[model samples]
Target chain A: MLDVADVHTYYGEGYVLQGVSLTVEPASIVAVLGRNGVGKTTLIRTVIAFTPARRGRVMFEDRDITRWPSYRIAKAGMGLVPQGRRIFPSLSVRENLEIAQRAAATDIAEPWSLGRVLDLFPALAERLRNGAGTLSGGEQQMLTVARALVGNPRLLLMDEPTEGLSPHIVAEMKKLVVGLRARGMAILLVEQNLAFALDVADRVHVMDKGKIVFGGTPAELDADETIKKTYLGV
Target chain B: MTFWIINTLNGLSLAMILFLLAAGLTLIFGLMHIINMAHGSFYLLGGYIAITAIRLTGGFIFGAIVAVIAIAVIGAIIQRLFLARLYKQEMRQALLTLGLLFIVADIAFFTWGGDPLLVPQPPLLQGAVHFWGIVYPLYRVFLIGCGLVIAFCLWAFLERTTLGAIVRAGMDDEEMVRGLGINVPLVFTGIFALGAALAALGGVLGGPLLGMFPGADFEVVLLAFVVVTVGGLGSIRGAFLGSLLVGLVDNFGNAWFPQLSLFTIFVPMVIVLALKPTGLMGRV
Candidate 1:
């Protein structure tokens, strides 16, 4: 479980995330839906300490990780697949996975190892020797996910994992998310894919202008067509 | 044919030194994005340290070890204390590190007068072997072997080890690497130190061939820049290949046309940039 409260983030002088607060329960997939440039990625970055929160606290498993460095936060069991699929372009598919591979103490049962990750994303295994940058968009996205999963993270922060993918790849990504949740991985998903969010997320928190405007079960958000149309434009 | 052979050997020797310097510069710059103008200063400092150590220890091996270790520690301190503060901003890093080069140069001059410093070759490596009846310095040949061995070892470290994997990852995306449970800052500091140590090693090995002097840092640094640029920014393979090309061209240029030698050195870089832009072995 992870807790972020009153986190304020800035890009240069302008305030981007103004006192945003949220919590993700254990083994749950929490979707944060927001319009473009609505601080969704900023929230994710702040939690992972890529862009540290100016004023707020981020707690992971009852430990205050607010001031912790990005690497320490990651070592504390948080994995992030950033907005862009920032795979090592020159490195092979296999090399990308192995690069972020660290054996932490609290690795899950049937832990996400190199072999397991490859099995989960078989396309990656097929292109093991191929450069990561040469992979298709879907393949790159899958490799990005596999790269993070190989780190054996307790809390996975996926920012727009299914973005810019074909429908088939999108469905496959949804299945992958559901499967991860079934395997008891806590995911803080920031996504623009509304129907996909509804399908995979147990709880939904709709963010607007840096604050969570809506937080409820998926069904509740689905029923509120006015709110969805107004905020998500779906 | 004999003249060509000698020129080729000279080119190889020059290439080896350039590779040693550029390999470190490329890695440190590519991974950390810090344009350390003081990188050549480390090379100069390494030579000075080796000279002093050899004087005290009276053994080349022991002296080499002392010199490498000392400068590596200094490299780490520089990264932690100065360069770390200027990450992602090349202009600031360039200005700061360039200033550091002057400071380090002045320190060396103050410590060991302005005259050219002589570095005696280890006795075991002093004798020459006749190649095509041409007398080649034993130290120069040793330097070639040392450079190749170091290059091979570096390739192995970057390709075979876990730490190297992290460095490769850090090079690809430093922020994401940090988010993946790897200590990126620690990796940055280590890489910087390793790179600095390599540059220093080149300086020590090359000191005997090219005497250690106050302006030597500037000379080597210019060569390093040309090598790195010609090879492509952030490409080790490119750096290696570029160094060979530059080394050959430089040697031949000087030998064949001494009047245009200085100008000819920058020609390959111009052509490479004009033709490939990304370099011969560089990635987009």
Candidate 2:
């Protein structure tokens, strides 16, 4: 489980996230939803400590990780499939998977080896030795998720994992997330896809202008047309 | 025919030394994106330290080992304390490293004085031998052998090891590597030390050829940059291939056409840039 409290993040001189707060229960997928540029990516980055909070606390399984370096945060069983598919363009699929393998606590008993990753994304297995950059946008997205899963992270933070993917790939990605949650991997999902979020997220937290505007189950979020229209702008 | 054979031999040997120096420089530049103007200082310091160690220990191997270890530790500290903060900023990194180079160069001048320090060869490797009816310097041969071994080892390191895989990944996207739970600082420090050690070893081996002189640091550093620029920055394989091209060109150019030797080095560089622009190995 991951917990963030009153976290303030800044980009250079501009305040990006003002006292943003959220939480994820163990083995649960929590979606942080909002309209475009509502600090969704910033919030995910702050939790992962890629963008360290200038104020407030981030706790991973009850450990105060506010000031932990990005790498250390990851080593503590958190994996991030960052905003874009930031795969090493020059590296092959196998090499990308090899690089993410750490002998962490959550890495043990994982079915997601290089083989399984390839199995999950069969198209990736076909392009094993191909340059990652040459992969289609959909394949790149799959590689990104498979890359994180190879790290065997306890908590996976996906920032707009479906952004720019084909509809078919996006559907496959949704199925993949559902499968991952079934395997009991905790995930903090950040997305703009309202229907997708409602389907996959056990609970939804709607963010607006650097603050959480609503926190409830997906059904509750679906029923609140007023909240959705105002903050999510559905 | 004999002249041709001797020239070829001479060029290959020179290529070996260039590879030793350029490989480290390229790796440092590629992974850290720091120009590391002080890398040549590490080379100069390695030679000076080796000279001192040789005098004290009275053995070439002992001196070489001590010098490399010392330089590696110094390199790690410098990266951890200084260059680590200036990552991703090219101008500041270049200026800061250049300042460090001046400091090291000044210290070398103050301690060793302006004269070229004598580096006496150990008894076993002091003499030349007749190979294929051509007399060659034993040290040059030793340099060629050592260069090949080191190059092979580095290749194996980059290709076969888990750490090397991580390094390759880091070279591609450092943020992604960091996001995967890798201690970027530790990897950076390790690589910085490795690059420094390689340069130091080259310094010791190449010391006799390029004696411990006042501006030796600048000269060798210039050559290393030329090598990197010609080969493409950050490619070890590029460094190897580029060094060979440079060494052969410089050597053959001087012998065949002394008037154009210097220009000969730049000619291939010009060609490479005209075509690739990023050099032979540069990804970005």
Candidate 3:
């Protein structure tokens, strides 16, 4: 459903995503794995046009969207669970969800509603009126994911969804990703955790420096010792 | 006792006007982070336009409405054409808006002439109301009521509505709001226009008591800056409390100790800043 063709992105003078290409079919989870500073985040940002691709094209649902602004791209069915769980600190949890509801892509049948998201994260439902800043790290991460889901996009771009969470919370996150994929939501997950990526990813792409160095099934990636040692530092 | 009561009423009336101006200032700064130095020009322009509209339409309410609408349109155009390009560049935004302040002031001077002009009070609020052996202008009391109504409406809008939720969210993390598929630029324009409209409404309302003069724009703008600074830069509730504090101090100080009036106004601000650098309700 989404295609990235030899995308090149840069952060000022530093080359980030160098001649990178990948694709995610409908209802599949494509996880990009790498160590810190391997341009994994840049690839996600490039897809969302936060860092516009300096070269190459991005096609979503058979349309060229490389030059579209981030908001337009989002409105056209791209939901971003950005790195760092950037929830609106001063706002209540309910306010955050309500704001997302305004921009939700309405064409999707059985769009993810507030009720459905609350069902997924009951903790958030209980803390609806509480300030988002007061939420714990795990709750904040859940809120971030719920915020994205409320937008009801056809494709989701999640950057390091399991970062900085405990083991149980990480397990919950993995389950959430699996659940989303089962519901036919295509997701592009950028992750540093190897086991979590292997657990949820339908396809795996290992990136290094600024390019994808390996692509295969999670089992194939796990079995390749040299590739993991060179790119991911195992 | 009567003297104190009269001065207190006068202080509250002036505070109401200040609140109207500061509310718009704080909201614009809070959401956009643009120090619109020219905001006072909209107030001055609104007063001048209302004066002309009143003369033509012979109705105070209609004149006020026209002035507000006109200034709102002007603010939206300026934001779209100029301020939109200078986001995050406070220096450029300041210079551009400062330039606008001067240009608008000059235009008002040319059109309205140099002398202070009095806004005609609405017929219903033209007389004085007598109570407890003291008298107060009915118009001034109406101004206070207007301020209260406006404060409530603004509070409700910011705290209770979906669009307001987006604005509040945008204030915290604009990039994330955009990532959520919101048209943030559109929200910005709408907010700028709303702020301008509020300032214009204040101008029309305050014209009768404050009088419209060439330098009134800068005077009120300076007072607004003081209000925003003392209340916390972006907090609307802070603006309200700050406006009342500054207003009461200015009026009561002038009544009881004219020599210390100017000093008294800054005293509260100094103390507030010393104790809480963020202003009363400011975050960060």
Candidate 4:
């Protein structure tokens, strides 16, 4: 479980995330939905401590991890699928996986492994030896998810995982998230695709101007037309 | 024909020595993106330390071992104490190393005096060998063998092992590599030590041929720059091939056009840059 409370993040003097709070329960997906540049990505970054909050608290499995280095936060079971699918372009897909692979967790009965992840994304399995840059856009997206899965983390922070992905691949991604939850992995997804977020997320929070404007169940979000019109514009 | 054969041998030996120095320089540049102006200083110090160690133990083996380990430890210390603070600050790190270069050079000059000391060869590697009635120094052959073996090992390490995979990945995106829960700083220190050890090894092997003297660091480092620039940054094959090209040209140029010897080593680099700014095998 991951909990972020009243987090304020900045870049130099520019305030990016202002008093943001969210919680991702075990074996569930919590998505933050908003239009572009509404601090959705910043929320993910702040939670992961990629850009540490100047004023706030981040509790991962009950430990205060704020001000810790990004690597330490990651080693403490936070795997980040960063925006833009930043895979090592020169390395082979196999090498990319190998570089991020970790020992499986003891508590989990069926831990994620290279073979297991490859089974999930067989397209990546075929191109294991090829350069990752040679992968198609959709395959690269798959590689990023698979790369994070191989890390065997307790929580995965996915930043716009469906961005630039085709509708067909996006459907596959939705299934993948549900499958991961079935295996008992917590995920915090940041997205701009309102319909996709509402479909996949158990709890949806709409963000605006560095603040969470609305939070509720997907059904409640669907029920409220006023919040949708004012913030979501849809 | 005999003259050409001897000249080729000379070039090959020189190529091996250059490879030793530039290989470390290129690796440090490739992985850390630090210019490491003190690389030449390490070479100078390694040669001086080896000579002292040889004199103390009266054996080349002791000198070589001490030189490599000492320089490696020193490199690790420097990285931890100073360079670690400047992580991702490439310009500041380079400036700090540039300052270290002068300080190290001064210390070596103060201790070693102005005289040029040729590194004594190991007892086992001493003397000449005759094959097909052509005589050659045994030490040069050993140096060439060492260079070739190291080249193969480095290539294998980078292309085959998982740790090497982490290194290659870090070269592309260090931040993401960190996000993978890897202790990247520890890896960087380990690599810095390895690179320093290689340069020290070069110093030990190059002692008998190039001789250790004041300002020798600049001269050797200049050649290393040309080699890395011509071959490419962050590429082992590039460094090896670049060394060969520069080595042969410098050898031939010195013999053929003594006055233009400096131009000979640099000409290839300029032409390579003009054609392909990334060098022969540079991926980044």
Residues A1-234, candidate 4, lDDT per residue (tens digit)?
799999999988989889999899999999888888889888877877777899999999999999888888888888989999999997999999998888866887887889999999999999999999999999999999999988899999999999999999999999989888888889999988888888988899999999999999999998999998888888
Candidate 2 chain A least-lDDT 10 residues: A103-112
Q: Which 10-residue window of candidate 4 chain A scores lowest in summed lDDT?
A: A42-51
Q: What's the C-alpha lDDT at position B85 in model 4?
A: 92
Better of 2 and 3 by lDDT: 3
Q: After superposition, how far is residue B27 of candidate 1 from its true place, in Å?
A: 0.8
Best by DockQ: 3
DockQ of each: 0.77, 0.77, 0.88, 0.81
TM-score of each: 0.96, 0.94, 0.96, 0.97
- Candidate 1 lDDT over residue span B14-60, tens digit each: 88988889998999877987777898899899999899999988888
The reply for model 2, stretches above 4 Å from the true place, is A104-112, A115-119, A230-233, B256-262
lDDT of 2: 0.86
**Total backbone clashes of model 2?**
0
TM-score of 3: 0.96
RMSD of each predicted structure: 1.6, 2.2, 1.6, 1.4
Q: How far in Å is the alpha carbon of B230 misplaced in model 3?
A: 0.8
True contacts kept of each: 0.82, 0.84, 0.90, 0.80
lDDT of model 4, residue B32: 92
lDDT of 2 by residue, B12-89 (tens): 887886787798888888899888888889888999999999998899899889989999999999999888887777
